[model samples]
Target: MTAKAERMASLPSSLPPFGVGRLKAAALFDISPSLFDRLVESRQLPQPRLLGGRLVWDVSELGDAWRSLPHRLEDIDGFTTTGNPWDE
Candidate 1:
């Protein structure tokens, strides 16, 4: 299995299959919370759903989205001079 698959498999199976909270999802992606936010803002990540008053991302959906990221997505990161999405 790939490293990402191994990491995903390591998550507790006891949790709901709909997946984890934002913080946990960021950790699972091996990205900082800020970067996760940026990805979401750029529509590179899947939209989250509200569950029991808390936002949660589906594991299957997240995995699929991560695998689908464009190769140039990383290259654009360095060219973005502004970190604030509101300014865009």
Candidate 2:
């Protein structure tokens, strides 16, 4: 690969809302589509824009949400953390 190609490959994939699908989002988060539905129902997830009858989420906003999930630790038995990493 050329230097430019290698550089691009090393960078994170930036997917705009128009290109993102619900299934792709769920897969990336290791969750089910039902969970995504709940997030949407509860308004926790980013509002999907209607583009040609397809629902999509903004990657930048979704990235922020993914980070917030770890921070908002509730009562999930599987997730183990010190509650707040900055609470030390």
Question: Evaluated with TM-score, which candidate comes out highest?
Answer: 1
lDDT of 2 by residue, 1-88 (tens): 9996896688678833334689987776778999988987898877777778888776777787787664454645675565757777
lDDT of 2 at 57: 74
Q: After superposition, how far is residue 15 of candidate 2 from its true place, in Å?
A: 7.6
The C-alpha stretches of model 2 lying farther than 4 A from their native spots are 1-18, 72-88
Residue-level lDDT tens digits of model 1 in 22-59: 89889978999999989888888988888888888889
Question: Which stretches of candidate 1 lie above 4 Å from their native place?
Answer: 1-16, 70-88
- For lDDT, the strongest prediction is 1
Model 1 Cα shift for residue 40 (angstroms): 0.8
